[model samples]
Target chain A: MAKNLLDVRNLSIHYKIQGGWVYAVDDVSFTLEKGETMGLVGESGCGKTTTGYGITQLLASNAYLKEGSKVIFDGKDFVQMSTVPSKEYKGYRKIVEYHPEMREYRWKRISMIFQGAMNAFNPVFKVGDQIIEAIKAHEDVTDEEARKRVEELYKLVGIPVDRIDNYPHEYSGGMKQRAMIAMALALNPDLIIADEPTTALDVVTQDRILGEMAKLQKREKVAMILITHDVSVVAEMAHKIAVMYAGHLVETGTTRQVFKETAHPYMEALLAAFPNIKKEKKERLKAIPGSPPDLANPPKGCRFAPRCPYAKDICLEEEPPVVEVAPGHYSKCHFAEELYGELGGGESNE
Target chain B: MSEENNDVVIRVRNLKKYFELHAGMFKFWGEPIYVKAVDGIDFDIHKGEILGLVGESGCGKTTTGRLLTRLEDPTEGNILFEGEDIAKLKGKELKSYRRNVQMIFQDPYESLNPRFTVQKTVMEPLIIHGIGESYDERVEMVIKALEDAELRPAEEYLDRFPHELSGGQRQRVAIARALVLRPKFIVADEPVSMLDVSIRAGVMNLMLDLRDKYNIPFLFITHDIAVSRYMSDKMAVMYLGKIVEMADSDEIVFNPMHPYTKALISAVPVPDPDHKHGRVQIKGEIPSPINLPPGCRFWPRCPYAKKGICDVKEPPLVEVEPGHYVACHFAEQLAAGELETGEEAKEVIEESEKIES
Candidate 1:
């Protein structure tokens, strides 16, 4: 079996709002193996971003992790030990400050590629110099060594080495995003969290960037958590898939199993809602009837019960447990087995 | 509902929109640089048909829409709406033109006035156009427009502010505002891009219903090809302020002639992993509009560009097949399957085993 890189269990996050607490992430749990790419997909207000932030310890001041939430990274409980500043490693002291306990793990162990590539770079500095600074900040390396690493990174991301000296304004949108990916890979981290990295690029440009990123991840054997609202994007590269609703993980499975043998009604609805390029045109897209539930005051039972077509009396009165339909596929639905029988293969469960 | 009955509602001929770029340090002495946002593009929208103007950012798709709606003044060309050139129309001519041709913006939240209630927001257009005889008549018209937009119990939503409504609801209100005038044409610029995926379909379906019921022609502008293919009867591919290809949505999708169009169609991510593996590689980024290339704007990035010929001569939009127009130096080569060697081309050809011929 592959070694596990990250394990998150019962992870819940809430934001202190004006009236009441906004439950951003509720009882979310998943594990990622080395060299695996997991896609966390959801709509606008879903807690996919919050789950990523919770793992990285980068939640805002207004946000707080609920009690009993645990994040284990490489066997170390990050939630428990995220406050102790590192005193052992004396490298990169001048560049990166060891303030928060999680600071040491941030760029060195795990990194994030933010949503917008336009705002990722500093306006005044050259792209090459900025990357070198990032490298020097994370590791005990000379300016020359960092510069060499930056040059290699640029090449890895398919950027010309000469254009590294160009300012942010000088580079095109796609080139800037490639540079952002290069920066994220500076430390050769164990895991990477890309939050809608290609949302801003053109379709052609988005394909190129994603293909390149997928290649890099495979070559380096690095685990990735790609967060996006588009299911098609995740379907391209993700090995494992996790569907998030208002604040819960509605489904989890391997890419093949989830796409072929989907067990949740929410997943089915999402698949139907997606506009497929390969499929013939339909009269109208199958839209989920109602909007996502409000996180401030969630409904009585399942969060998706209001919009689910298969929603029943049991779905309305009690929360559904995460049931394993197949050996590896799990879905949070009251009738996961029935759904598997109905939509997955159309065979009787008996 | 046949080709014989279809009438050309709007004809855009050689539309151009040039924006002046600032010259740094030599502001007074140096010659001004013009960014040709929409450099002489031509197309037509038939009655009650959805013409999808598809392109990436800065491709002049939005500018073309704005020019047609009279929101932005076109530097050159004739916008023939109902046999009259409305490009240079002013005063009362412009006012009446605005009433006939309405616009639906991309951002619903920003498009609506937060201070105004739903009733006032929809009524503003009718009031400006002087449509109703009295206040009560105008109120009745507003209710009917809201109902037409699929916002049921229109009276209940009249007093609600824009903030109280959802993103999809707000877009419905925007649609209602546009429909209140009973416009002959509607320019919907990325109307559903801001809404969530689940909510997006509702708005899209609503637009289709309105198109069918009102028989209103829509110049739908979007970057998303899937949505465009779903909503449009005809689609035009734009690149660097030029129409690279234009045809029936099926023809443009199934048998793309232009290399740029093929690459664009291939670039869209399908929800199936089994569909394709390798990406269609376009060499470089979209060139800046200010310093467009000499021969063809897309020559630098096109994979099938013939070196000497493509760089020296601009390809005119020609009809190689009936009703399908393509602008490419090697359109013949592309159609012949001569350039279909790579994985990208293979993927595009076999986009699905299920697509009906």
Candidate 2:
């Protein structure tokens, strides 16, 4: 077996509600190689962010990872040990003792770059001070060493070192994002989970920032799990992609497999929803009617069946198991195999 | 109805908007510097075409939008809405002009008064326009407007406040108010920039759907090219408060004539892994609009700038290919021939500056 960086099996992260558990991530599983970029995509409320939180063991108070869920990352089982018992679960017993605390893996091993970086940094403090604090908090570096690291990180992220003394407000939307990336890289973590990093930026800035991030990933050999709604942004960086709809994995495959040959109806709707430059100016866009379902009480059958045009009787009666349609291509729909890549009516080989 | 059907509705020429920097508290004797927000940009909005005003932050896209809707008067130049100088119109006539052009603001939360209910919000525009004579008539109009905006089963949404509704619903209400007046042209300023991705398409589709239903022309101002590409019939690229490029939306995206247009196109993220990902990355930062560089406003940052001419002489908007107009000294070079990349242009600028000094 090849050595993988992050691997999970039967991963189920749940949220407490009044009547029943939310099942934010139900039996969700994927792996990230040492230096690969995997895109975790979904609609607004899907468990993409929660999955990131679960991997980092930073799940919120209302959320908890179920027992027997195995998450092996960097030779450490971040998931708690089983009470059902095993010889290898001796070291994991300590983590099992404390249910809430995250074994101090927040900043050192992996970090997350949240959406709206403007609010991530403090208003009062200068960007320079923030970077320095980030460095010192993770490692045993002195103030001077951290300051030097801050300058290096600033220059690396394309923001001028001179602007380090400036407050966060003085920076543009893109520049603020660079400062956030600089702070995140200050710890030199192996993996960075970025959530909608370029959501607020203009196209020009978005391209530049994404380019910088791609370059940094290449040079550092760091794994990036980018979560965004923009398919274009995901296509730019991520090698493999996953499309989530209403907390279910609709499609997951290589970029070529997904973009060229989208299997699920939700993916088809999402692609059609995007404005192609080839489209006529005054032409109407056919929107996907009916919003995502309520996670607390999702539908009996397919969560996306209400909005899905190709939905059938079976789709409304039972949840489709995620099956491998092709070589490493997975989708959770009863009719996915027959209807694979039929949205644009193009073959995967094409 | 298309843009040509109704004829040209709005035209702006040599529009210059400069804000005088008032002297601070201490001395108050220094010369007041002017912040030229909109510096000599010209474009036309044909009868009902969705003319997109595109640019990054501080490029005066929003300011130009405000000027079009007459939310703010220009410091200099004329905005001919239906062949009438909007600046000259004031008092009673200006109030009437306001009804002809309604403005949809960016933040739906801030634009709407929190205290007002959906019915009251939609009715304010009706009352101001002084249409639908009776109270019940006005209520009828409001319901119709709500239905048009996709707030279906209008009765349920009538009494709900802005806070009670979702972000998508609030934006729909904003659209409803704008539509209630039955305006010919609307300046929708960053309408969906704040909404969630899933909901943004819904709001955008509503705008386009309403455009067809009302035959209403919109001056859609947005920084996102994807939205602009889908929404705008004709497009204008603004750089440093000036109209740098103008052409049909498809033409601009597929075959960008101007260097700025090319850069902007390359900047748009293409969701195709087969595509070569290393795009033309413009480094540094957007120069301060307050102290804009001489010659071409973009010449300082333009990749194609050459010699002392760029620093000393400004370029005019020249017709490069048919309807495509680009404002650049090297527009011809790019139009007839492929010149160089942004990096190569930067190198040329460096050498030229060194020789001049």
Candidate 2 structure quality by residue, lDDT tens digits, A98-215:
3433535666678788898978889899989988887776578888888888889988988888998999888888889999888778787888989889887777888778877887
Using lDDT as the measure, the top candidate is: 1
Interface RMSD of each: 4.5, 4.6
lDDT, residue B193, candidate 1: 92
Clashing pairs in 2: none
Off by over 4 Å in 2: A17-23, A81-103, A278-284, A345-350, B1-6, B22-27, B196-198, B338-357
Residue runs of model 1 more than 4 Å from their true location after superposition: A83-100, A281-283, A344-350, B1-6, B22-31, B339-357
Candidate 1 residue-wise lDDT, B88-151, digit = tens: 9999989989989999999999999999999999999988888899999999999999999889
Residue range A1-350, candidate 1, lDDT tens digits: 22688999998778878877798899999999998999999999899999996788777756666666778998887766653222432210111224465788898899999989889899999999998998887689998899899889999998999998899999989999999999999999999999999998999899888878887897898999999999889888799999999999999999877777889888888777777766654545678897998899989788899998889999999999999999889999999988884662101100
Give the CA lDDT, 0 to 100, for residue B166 in model 2: 78
* DockQ of the candidate models in sequence: 0.44, 0.40
